[model samples]
Target: MQLEPGAVVEGRITRVTDFGAFIQFDNGETGLVHISQIAHSFVRNIHDHVREGESIEVKVLGRDERGRLDLSIKELLEEPEEVPRPRAIGRQSPQFEAKLRSFMRDAKERTTSGAPVKKSTSTKRKK
Candidate 1:
Protein backbone atom coordinates (compact mmCIF):
# COMPACT_ATOMS: atom_id res chain seq x y z
CA MET A 1 0.00 0.00 0.00
CA GLN A 2 3.06 2.25 0.43
CA LEU A 3 3.31 4.25 -2.78
CA GLU A 4 6.92 5.03 -3.72
CA PRO A 5 8.17 7.43 -6.34
CA GLY A 6 7.94 6.09 -9.91
CA ALA A 7 5.25 3.62 -8.88
CA VAL A 8 2.51 3.04 -11.42
CA VAL A 9 -0.96 2.46 -9.98
CA GLU A 10 -4.51 2.10 -11.16
CA GLY A 11 -6.90 4.48 -9.46
CA ARG A 12 -10.38 5.94 -9.73
CA ILE A 13 -11.00 9.65 -10.09
CA THR A 14 -12.67 10.70 -6.82
CA ARG A 15 -13.14 14.30 -7.85
CA VAL A 16 -12.26 16.77 -10.57
CA THR A 17 -11.36 20.45 -10.24
CA ASP A 18 -10.13 23.32 -12.33
CA PHE A 19 -6.56 22.73 -11.20
CA GLY A 20 -6.45 18.93 -10.96
CA ALA A 21 -8.19 15.65 -10.27
CA PHE A 22 -8.20 13.58 -7.08
CA ILE A 23 -7.35 9.89 -7.52
CA GLN A 24 -8.11 7.22 -4.96
CA PHE A 25 -5.89 4.16 -5.36
CA ASP A 26 -7.17 0.64 -4.83
CA ASN A 27 -5.24 0.58 -1.53
CA GLY A 28 -7.36 3.56 -0.30
CA GLU A 29 -4.48 6.04 -0.64
CA THR A 30 -5.28 9.20 -2.59
CA GLY A 31 -3.27 11.60 -4.79
CA LEU A 32 -3.63 14.65 -7.00
CA VAL A 33 -2.89 14.74 -10.71
CA HIS A 34 -2.09 18.40 -11.42
CA ILE A 35 -3.51 20.04 -14.54
CA SER A 36 -0.08 20.27 -16.16
CA GLN A 37 0.43 16.50 -15.69
CA ILE A 38 -3.04 15.61 -17.02
CA ALA A 39 -2.03 15.64 -20.68
CA HIS A 40 1.00 15.80 -22.98
CA SER A 41 -0.28 19.00 -24.56
CA PHE A 42 -1.55 22.16 -22.83
CA VAL A 43 -4.66 21.48 -20.71
CA ARG A 44 -6.78 24.60 -20.29
CA ASN A 45 -9.48 22.57 -18.54
CA ILE A 46 -8.90 19.48 -16.39
CA HIS A 47 -12.39 18.15 -17.19
CA ASP A 48 -11.40 17.84 -20.84
CA HIS A 49 -8.88 15.13 -19.92
CA VAL A 50 -10.56 13.17 -17.09
CA ARG A 51 -13.97 12.77 -15.51
CA GLU A 52 -15.11 11.87 -12.00
CA GLY A 53 -15.48 8.10 -11.29
CA GLU A 54 -13.19 7.27 -14.21
CA SER A 55 -10.44 4.67 -13.75
CA ILE A 56 -6.96 5.69 -14.86
CA GLU A 57 -3.35 4.63 -14.60
CA VAL A 58 -0.88 7.19 -13.27
CA LYS A 59 2.77 7.36 -12.20
CA VAL A 60 3.79 8.64 -8.79
CA LEU A 61 5.94 11.78 -9.13
CA GLY A 62 6.86 11.50 -5.46
CA ARG A 63 5.38 13.19 -2.40
CA ASP A 64 5.29 16.89 -1.70
CA GLU A 65 6.59 18.62 1.42
CA ARG A 66 3.27 17.81 3.15
CA GLY A 67 3.77 14.11 2.22
CA ARG A 68 0.86 14.28 -0.23
CA LEU A 69 1.24 12.01 -3.27
CA ASP A 70 1.74 13.83 -6.58
CA LEU A 71 0.88 11.91 -9.72
CA SER A 72 1.14 12.37 -13.51
CA ILE A 73 -0.98 10.86 -16.29
CA LYS A 74 1.08 12.49 -19.03
CA GLU A 75 4.17 10.57 -17.93
CA LEU A 76 2.30 7.28 -18.40
CA LEU A 77 1.16 8.36 -21.89
CA GLU A 78 3.26 7.85 -25.02
CA GLU A 79 5.71 10.54 -26.10
CA PRO A 80 4.43 13.22 -28.48
CA GLU A 81 5.74 13.77 -31.99
CA GLU A 82 8.73 16.08 -32.29
CA VAL A 83 8.16 19.28 -34.23
CA PRO A 84 10.59 20.20 -37.02
CA ARG A 85 12.76 23.21 -36.30
CA PRO A 86 12.93 25.96 -38.88
CA ARG A 87 16.31 26.55 -40.53
CA ALA A 88 17.67 30.00 -41.34
CA ILE A 89 17.96 30.72 -45.09
CA GLY A 90 21.50 31.10 -46.53
CA ARG A 91 23.03 29.92 -43.25
CA GLN A 92 26.07 27.77 -44.15
CA SER A 93 29.62 27.31 -42.78
CA PRO A 94 31.18 29.13 -45.75
CA GLN A 95 28.77 32.04 -45.35
CA PHE A 96 29.50 32.16 -41.62
CA GLU A 97 33.27 32.21 -42.27
CA ALA A 98 32.84 35.00 -44.84
CA LYS A 99 30.76 37.00 -42.37
CA LEU A 100 33.41 36.49 -39.66
CA ARG A 101 36.15 37.70 -42.04
CA SER A 102 34.06 40.72 -43.01
CA PHE A 103 33.46 41.54 -39.33
CA MET A 104 37.20 41.25 -38.53
CA ARG A 105 38.05 43.51 -41.49
CA ASP A 106 35.47 46.10 -40.32
CA ALA A 107 36.78 45.95 -36.75
CA LYS A 108 40.37 46.36 -37.99
CA GLU A 109 39.37 49.33 -40.16
CA ARG A 110 37.56 50.98 -37.19
CA THR A 111 40.60 50.45 -34.94
CA THR A 112 43.04 51.79 -37.58
CA SER A 113 40.77 54.81 -38.32
CA GLY A 114 40.64 57.65 -35.77
CA ALA A 115 36.76 57.77 -35.97
CA PRO A 116 34.63 56.34 -33.12
CA VAL A 117 32.54 53.30 -34.10
CA LYS A 118 28.76 53.78 -33.84
CA LYS A 119 26.84 51.30 -31.71
CA SER A 120 24.55 49.01 -33.71
CA THR A 121 20.83 49.25 -32.97
CA SER A 122 18.36 46.35 -33.00
CA THR A 123 17.04 45.41 -36.44
CA LYS A 124 13.52 44.82 -35.07
CA ARG A 125 11.35 47.86 -35.74
CA LYS A 126 8.74 48.85 -33.16
CA LYS A 127 5.12 48.74 -34.25
Candidate 2:
Protein backbone atom coordinates (compact mmCIF):
# COMPACT_ATOMS: atom_id res chain seq x y z
CA MET A 1 0.00 0.00 0.00
CA GLN A 2 1.23 3.50 -0.84
CA LEU A 3 1.77 5.54 2.34
CA GLU A 4 0.24 8.85 1.31
CA PRO A 5 0.65 12.05 3.26
CA GLY A 6 -1.49 12.34 6.42
CA ALA A 7 -2.05 8.62 6.42
CA VAL A 8 -1.65 6.76 9.72
CA VAL A 9 -0.41 3.20 9.55
CA GLU A 10 1.34 0.48 11.53
CA GLY A 11 5.01 -0.24 10.98
CA ARG A 12 7.90 -2.19 12.49
CA ILE A 13 11.11 -0.53 13.60
CA THR A 14 13.86 -1.82 11.34
CA ARG A 15 16.71 0.22 12.80
CA VAL A 16 17.27 2.86 15.45
CA THR A 17 19.81 5.68 15.17
CA ASP A 18 20.79 8.72 17.17
CA PHE A 19 18.89 10.98 14.76
CA GLY A 20 15.81 8.82 14.20
CA ALA A 21 14.38 5.36 13.63
CA PHE A 22 13.62 3.53 10.39
CA ILE A 23 10.24 1.84 10.17
CA GLN A 24 9.22 -0.78 7.63
CA PHE A 25 5.55 -1.06 6.78
CA ASP A 26 3.71 -4.28 5.92
CA ASN A 27 3.88 -3.44 2.22
CA GLY A 28 7.69 -3.16 2.46
CA GLU A 29 7.58 0.65 2.29
CA THR A 30 10.05 2.29 4.68
CA GLY A 31 9.97 5.64 6.41
CA LEU A 32 11.93 7.61 9.01
CA VAL A 33 10.60 8.96 12.31
CA HIS A 34 12.84 11.76 13.52
CA ILE A 35 13.84 12.12 17.18
CA SER A 36 11.77 15.28 17.61
CA GLN A 37 8.71 13.34 16.45
CA ILE A 38 9.26 10.57 18.98
CA ALA A 39 7.57 12.33 21.90
CA HIS A 40 6.31 15.66 23.24
CA SER A 41 9.37 16.11 25.49
CA PHE A 42 13.04 16.25 24.55
CA VAL A 43 14.59 13.00 23.37
CA ARG A 44 18.23 12.67 24.43
CA ASN A 45 18.45 9.07 23.31
CA ILE A 46 16.40 7.47 20.55
CA HIS A 47 16.80 4.01 22.09
CA ASP A 48 15.02 5.22 25.23
CA HIS A 49 11.84 5.68 23.16
CA VAL A 50 12.17 3.04 20.48
CA ARG A 51 14.40 0.09 19.63
CA GLU A 52 15.05 -2.19 16.69
CA GLY A 53 12.22 -4.62 15.90
CA GLU A 54 9.57 -2.66 17.78
CA SER A 55 6.09 -2.27 16.35
CA ILE A 56 4.44 1.19 16.53
CA GLU A 57 1.86 3.35 14.85
CA VAL A 58 3.03 6.34 12.84
CA LYS A 59 1.58 9.06 10.65
CA VAL A 60 2.88 9.74 7.15
CA LEU A 61 4.30 13.32 7.05
CA GLY A 62 4.89 13.26 3.31
CA ARG A 63 8.29 12.87 1.62
CA ASP A 64 11.48 14.85 1.76
CA GLU A 65 13.54 16.44 -1.03
CA ARG A 66 15.20 13.10 -1.59
CA GLY A 67 11.80 11.41 -1.82
CA ARG A 68 12.29 9.58 1.48
CA LEU A 69 9.14 9.05 3.51
CA ASP A 70 8.88 11.07 6.71
CA LEU A 71 6.85 9.63 9.56
CA SER A 72 5.78 10.93 13.00
CA ILE A 73 4.86 9.06 16.19
CA LYS A 74 4.26 12.01 18.45
CA GLU A 75 1.54 13.26 16.12
CA LEU A 76 -0.52 10.24 17.06
CA LEU A 77 0.03 10.80 20.79
CA GLU A 78 -1.91 13.44 22.75
CA GLU A 79 -0.10 16.69 23.40
CA PRO A 80 0.85 17.56 27.00
CA GLU A 81 -1.09 20.24 28.86
CA GLU A 82 0.80 23.49 29.43
CA VAL A 83 1.20 24.62 33.04
CA PRO A 84 0.17 28.25 33.69
CA ARG A 85 2.85 30.48 35.17
CA PRO A 86 2.24 32.28 38.47
CA ARG A 87 1.05 35.89 38.22
CA ALA A 88 3.53 38.66 38.90
CA ILE A 89 3.55 40.31 42.36
CA GLY A 90 1.31 43.37 42.74
CA ARG A 91 2.53 46.98 43.12
CA GLN A 92 4.56 47.97 46.19
CA SER A 93 2.67 48.93 49.41
CA PRO A 94 2.00 52.59 50.35
CA GLN A 95 4.57 52.51 53.21
CA PHE A 96 7.24 51.12 50.88
CA GLU A 97 6.50 53.81 48.27
CA ALA A 98 6.70 56.51 50.92
CA LYS A 99 10.10 55.25 52.10
CA LEU A 100 11.41 55.14 48.51
CA ARG A 101 10.26 58.71 47.84
CA SER A 102 11.87 59.95 51.06
CA PHE A 103 15.17 58.28 50.21
CA MET A 104 15.16 59.78 46.69
CA ARG A 105 14.40 63.25 48.09
CA ASP A 106 17.27 63.01 50.58
CA ALA A 107 19.69 61.82 47.85
CA LYS A 108 18.69 64.70 45.54
CA GLU A 109 19.13 67.22 48.36
CA ARG A 110 22.62 65.90 49.24
CA THR A 111 23.69 65.90 45.57
CA THR A 112 22.39 69.41 44.94
CA SER A 113 24.10 70.73 48.08
CA GLY A 114 27.36 68.97 47.17
CA ALA A 115 27.41 67.53 50.71
CA PRO A 116 28.92 64.11 51.38
CA VAL A 117 26.60 61.51 52.89
CA LYS A 118 27.33 61.23 56.62
CA LYS A 119 26.91 57.94 58.53
CA SER A 120 25.03 58.41 61.83
CA THR A 121 26.90 56.92 64.83
CA SER A 122 24.83 58.91 67.38
CA THR A 123 22.59 55.84 67.82
CA LYS A 124 25.52 53.88 69.27
CA ARG A 125 24.77 53.11 72.95
CA LYS A 126 27.30 52.51 75.77
CA LYS A 127 27.58 48.89 76.91
User: Which regions of candidate 1 fall more than 4 Å away from where they truly are?
Assistant: 83-127
- Write model 1 residue lDDT over 1-127, tens digit each, in one string: 6589998989999999999999999788899999989877777778878999999999999999999999999999887796334565875799899999999999899999989878899999999
Compute each candidate's TM-score over C-alphas.
Answer: 0.63, 0.63
| TM match of model 2 to true structure | 0.63
For each candidate in the order shown, give its overall lDDT on alpha carbons. 0.90, 0.91
Q: Return the TM-score for candidate 1, rounded to 2 decimals.
A: 0.63
Q: Candidate 2: deviation at residue 73, Å? A: 0.3
Model 1 pairs whose backbones collide? none
User: Tens-digit lDDT track for model 2 on 29-127?
Assistant: 899999989988778788899989989999999999998999999999988897335567999999999999999998899889977777767877899
Residue 5 in candidate 1 has what lDDT? 96
Best by lDDT: 2
Pairs of colliding residues, candidate 2: none
